[model samples]
Target: MESEQAERFTATLEDKLQSLLTKASTLQPEEMLIRHNGLLYPALLCPEDNLRQFAKFDARPEDMCIASYPKCGFNWVNQLFRDIAAAVRKDDGQRKIILLEFSGADTHQVINSYPSPRVYGTHCHYENLPASVIEKKTKVLVVFRNPKDNAVSYYHFCQKHPLLPNSASWDEFFKEYMAGEVAWGSYFDSALIWEKHIDDEHVMIITYEELKENLIGGVQKIAEFYGFSLSVEQIENIARKGTFQAMSDNSQETHSIFGNFFFRKGVVGDWRNLFTEEQSREMDAKFEECLAGTKLGAKLKYDLYCKT
Candidate 1:
């Protein structure tokens, strides 16, 4: 289902990006990071110019998007969706531009030229999605994880990613995380926005815990939502191949750029080890403030995963 698609971005950095690429390559995250729309981001990627160009993209009727904040099950679910697409379409399920997170407008032009059913992923908030996605009513599969664990994985990821700044400690990172100071903006701010769309026909929302609990069922639901019909046997095979261990073993095949840093533990309870009691309380309070009684809040099952 997956084929190497890295060559598209291999050209030498464009002239306009020279400064950002230089800083992203040579400087620490502290010195290299930039802010866009109140969110801190790696200097080299998620450029405003590219994002502006992306806004003008003409989304196709068949275009479907997979979205999540960083460190949610983005890689896993994106791969799973492709596997399903391959089995259904019986073709190489290739996608251009991993996520529309680049510094050049050429990427958007290349995407416009790609074949139909162009599946793309994004970490941007729902409103920031391409305007055409809304006008065209393109379907989006949005995945969210318990933020406690999300923060832990993302904190470590920043250290490993050369372009982003590093946090001196988990405490420092957690502070920024709660403040919505990291890239992609505040998790809560976006979560609340997504909650309003819980009943939307075009949006299919799932949680990492739900996928972990029932990969086969989750896969089926995803396939059905996208109108991709897969036989029961095919769904099972896809689910088995997508288990955490299978994803970890074959990650190099799918996401070799990050090396081992693309995935760490990926366990639900790992945050228990990193968060202090005060931090846990703070997370609970934050959840209460933003997502307490909403339908999406119930979907996150915060007490079961984040509290207990």
Candidate 2:
């Protein structure tokens, strides 16, 4: 009995998992939307409890974090981070990339046990992150995508994620998205919080558009921020393997469960296909309201990707 509790995800993963299965069978979609601290979460993941548990995580100065709003190129950026890390440390290439808030506390425990220069992540709003992340001065990489594309990707993801309420269509999802009724809450609210930290000495903010525009340069830039000094050859090699096509080809091997669900078109401006003139204008107005005049806003280059 004691041994069973000794497992890492005792409360959230092990305990809540059964509840998730049970609830998934019995509960309506709306019933499954758990609210905590003014944010919405899927009951299956029990993110509120997991987040409360993650609050105790003992952050280390050497830890590097990938902090972002969901569907904002996290997987692709994570792939690049892993490629660059493996090229540098030559470890099993598995030490990096774990779900921060979504994974159970037990997983965070395992992370605590790992050695230095650890790579961890969160898709929470900036203010909701563990306070220790700021107190410890842990290096963070913030990734954002244009809101239209981000919303479109997340809407599709909701269909496949068992923990999430699947939207019947993009139109319905867009209304919920604009209202910040989906999991992880509003992107605009998150951008507002993170915009304040863009220039912090320990934080590096980059956008999907920027990385797409300059993959090699972006990889090199992120590597250097994490205190890695890679040769140009190594940067080129990492970029080669980290390309969208290359990663998509290997997604089944790496993300065996979800397979290629995480890899749609991997393109910017895809929202163009789905969004109407009104929707585009709404997203544009929101961006200007939440992020305009900030350094992150400039970094996102709104005129280039999200301009009306």
Candidate 3:
């Protein structure tokens, strides 16, 4: 009797999986870029899955790169940078922040269409990026969050995204994510790769927790790093507008303003709501084992429950 029950459960699981895949296959191709190992890959549903390659990085003195593991405060940092740039320039109109993606539709072409002093967002792992970006001394601002939080956020992101394969449960998603089978591979590995170059003059590592703890100070440091001096009034203005409450309230503003809702939730400790105690421990073990000797282990102190 027990054997029969087990077999039935397995069959039911398989049927559910098939149903989910059918739903995913029917989703129309959204305009957002697909990412792989940090490099943006072409849309999965595109006619040909031809991954877009990055052009030679023609980094000018004013070029800036905002790099992050997905859902690790990437959009928030980009918005903050845009606000600061605008404050420094004293312009209030809708400013075009040229986001350069390695894959998907030609964002480079759009960036080229615009003028100088561009702010570009990318998730391309350090080794995969264009050589010019490194050699030409372009400014790089890397933001990383706790891996546990990142995993939870990524799971939620995939659930809402028609482009990704949706998991029936958090357990199923965690299995693929730990094995690096999911898009962009392991978040812990991605952070370690960038952490190696963190001390370079052109690269600065910013933790999402640190940024959340001190928003105004964080923005000031970023401005100073980029050699942009701002007045007290300007700093206050940028900080006020960049708050999570403020950004979330503004529907017009998001990571995918024209497409999907990229800025879903800006809060931390969201993993607790979704992760079981056993699953949380499993994730912590994975983090400890995988990131044992890496620089990121030192930089990002993971609190699975965000207690500390």
Best candidate according to lDDT:
2
| Candidate 3 RMSD to the correct structure | 12.5
Best by TM-score: 1
Off by over 4 Å in 2: 1-26
Full candidate order by TM-score, most accurate first? 1, 2, 3
TM-score for predicted model 1 compared with the true structure: 0.90
Q: Which ten residues in a row have the lowest lDDT in candidate 3?
A: 44-53
Off by over 4 Å in 3: 1-51, 55-57, 102-106, 253-260, 292-295, 303-308
lDDT of each: 0.79, 0.80, 0.68
Model 2, position 223, has a per-residue lDDT of 92
Question: How close is every model to the real structure, measured as TM-score?
Answer: 0.90, 0.89, 0.79
Question: Which residues of candidate 1, in runs, are more than 4 Å off?
Answer: 1-23, 94-97
Angstrom error of the Cα, residue 242, model 2: value is: 1.1
Cα lDDT tens digits, model 3, 199-223, are 7888888888888888999999999
TM-score pick, better of 1 and 2: 1
Instruction: Please state every model's RMSD to the true fold in angstroms.
Output: 3.1, 3.9, 12.5
